[model samples]
Target: MKVNIPWVVGLTIAALGAAGLGGQTARVPGSDADPASCAAGSGRITIATGNSTGVYYVMGGALARLVNGHTDVRAGAAETGASVQNIRQLVAGDYDVAFSLADAADAAVRGTSPFGEPQKIRTLGRIYPNYTQIVVRADSGIRTVADFKGKTISTGSPLSGTEAIATKLIDAAGLDELDVNRQRLDLTKTVDGMKDGSIDGLVWSGGLPTSALTDLYTTLGSEDLRMIDPTPLLPEMKKKSAVYDTATIPKATYDLPADVPTIAVPNVLLVRDDMPANLACALTTLVYDNRQALGAAHPAGKDIRVDEADRTAPIRLHPGSERALAGLTSR
Candidate 1:
């Protein structure tokens, strides 16, 4: 079955752009000069996404299309390893925008997550909520976090936000990160391991109803698979930062027994603090104005709203974003 990305990404609505898609220069309006101004140019803007199976990749691509369609700017989306990689490249000027998780975004701003120093990233807006999903085969006998004492598990890839969430979830579940058999693999390999029983469990954090996850659930069937609810430990998670909260993955999403309580984190659109202001303003304006068109392509894009542009974590809004938020700009 063909899953519609734009319709199912968010509980509220739409998503946007981020990294390694290709080389993205700038498509500035011919009139843009003042870094704080919005004008015109003809070039390219690149957005970094995440693991191909995750919502970030789909939504990021849709956002790039939306920007290219709505604004004078030409844009493209690149598939990336996700938040950590996206943030690092975004600051290095390898990318103009990136899709990042709030936790990593917070960590980057405060110089916490995977980076050793404070990053210069700024926010475009809060796009969507990522649900922490832990899937395990019924035969694994992993009823609780502690039950996975020596079981093989996929903790996600390095330099990806999935690893960050997996580590924290393992901690919150009262398990030792080192005690579990950890395999840091990407989505494709993780699914393969789970199917073959080489991995007893796997952790993935992404927008509701991840495509790879849907495949996992369908292949595993109800008798062989289940989700581990992590909401009871939310208080412990919040201690790490305010970026995490309670989220529910409806039974209808993966055909689970019920809504599984889990940790919720927001997805953010990011740019360098020094990004051209006019471009920022124009980009921000294009998103809010053309959200419907975007939503038609990726459900997560429905969440991109100028009114809520300041919802990003500890990161500050770009000057252009601020102007757009205040209704004084377009992009």
Candidate 2:
């Protein structure tokens, strides 16, 4: 049974140099220069997004369209390894904006492991939440994390928020990384593995109704696939980071028998601390103002609400984003 995933149609929508802004100064953020004086110049900018099948990629495309249609910024969304990598490249000036998981963003700003030194980054705003989806073959007899000791599992792409949470969840379950055969594959490959019985399970942190998983369920059905409740590790997960919370994946999301309980982490759109104030302001406003259009692309976009946009903490909001939000809420 072949399923057509609409989102993958134009996967590589635009290249980093697609907008042709060579030689000229790229609007790379993170400098001590006064953001107020920097004009919102007309040029191409890249957005670092996640796996092609994940919500970040879908929403990133939608965002790029919004920016292009409404502002002077010529935006392009690139598929990346997600959170950790996105933040790293965003700092290096490879990309102007990035979508990152809150926990990873917190680690980046605090100079924690996986990050060599503290980074100077600021949030456009908190967008949606990522629910940890742990799916196992019903025939694999993997009832809990402990059962994963001898089974093969896909832990998500390296340097991704999915990998970070997968590792923490395994540790919280009292299993060493050596206990399981870990595979670091992206969602597309992981789904392929699941289809062929080469992979026993997969741990993915993504938005509800992730296109890849939807494809998986559509092809494999409930008789062969199932999601596990990992809420038991919430206390342990929270001990390491306050950002960890519990969320439910409604049975309807993938047509399961019942709701699945899992760990949740908020996602944020990050930009360098030194981004021009006006550019940041315009981008932030464009997102909220065109919320309906973004939502039309993916359900996750609807979750990006104005009321919850400024909830990003630890990582300060960009001054321009703050100005945008201030004006938005006041009206």
Candidate 3:
């Protein structure tokens, strides 16, 4: 369904440019800037991140630091349930922005998947792929993705993007959710459970070189831990969730048998529809303008660039974001 925008947005944005609007309350371009004012850094925005041990937490924190460092924007990242929760909080106006999987972002826009209705969200850009990380204890004999039958696996937190991807992958592998001991938990808890022998395997969707996965593997310190490639089931996965695609995690990451074949979903930085255009444009500009500085704070930040700010999949660009890109290209 198309969004119904009032005719006044144009005027609001034009005014924002004239008034030198800044921050969340800035006006949309072409419209009259709000006669009132928007303070640039009056409040701190809290980013709802994923499991503390996961990439979402790491990157979310990096994003907060990145935005804080370059603009008059102060921010912080907090551990959350990820995806579904992140989107919900963002729409609820609790989170200024979020780290979400492409599947979840599509679902949010289409009003499908776990959402009850359509939401007003816009994409900043698609970042790197979050590979479906299928990890198994070496002794578990899970050399193949299909070997997860009857095994205890932590798919992901309830209604989480990871869980959504994990379930589809399981089904594509010809295994039903009921066929295995499906454990719903975050990455930290999943790792702890794996260490304690409570879980036989785990399927997580995250960026490459996750610090938590690194620590988990290092702490396990045995030949038994392995990253099982999932590309073998890609065709079937697509049938279930079109969001799935093929990607590879380099062998250098964990020193595995070879490069790991995996299923990946894009990541997005989302914002609410009601947000001020100038502020949204500013935030989008900051990500690309100060990308190098952001990268210095965290490796994930390096994934961002002016060249890729329009890369988010299956979602429309925000008008403000488009304006920002237009300004960049005009230079």
Can you rank all candidates by TM-score, best first? 2, 1, 3
Candidate 1, residue 189: Cα displacement in angstroms equals 1.2
Q: After superposition, which runs of candidate 1 have C-alpha atoms over 4 Å from their true positions?
A: 1-37, 303-307, 328-331
Instruction: Return whichever of 2 and 3 wins on lDDT.
Output: 2
> Which lDDT values do the candidates have, in the order given?
0.77, 0.86, 0.74
Per-residue alpha-carbon lDDT of candidate 3 for residues 1-331, written as tens digits (9 for 90 to 100)? 2222221211222343354544557423223343122223333455667887777777776666655655455566767789988899889866777889888888898888688888899976666668788898887878886898988899899878889888877888888778988999888898988888888999988877787788787788547698888888888877755767888888777666678778887788888876666666766776777667656655666766566668665677777788777777678
Better of 2 and 3 by TM-score: 2
TM-score of each: 0.86, 0.91, 0.83
What TM-score would you give candidate 2 relative to the actual structure? 0.91
lDDT of 2 by residue, 1-331 (tens): 2222222223232343444544555444323334553234466667889999999998998887776666555667888999999999889877888999999998999999789899999999989899999999999999888788989999999999999999989999999999999999999999999999999999999998899999999999988997989999999999877888989999999999999888899999999987888788878888888889888999988788899899988889999999889988988
Could you tell me the TM-score of candidate 3? Answer: 0.83
Residue 181 alpha-carbon offset, candidate 1, angstroms: 1.1
**Comparison by lDDT, 1 against 3, better one:** 1
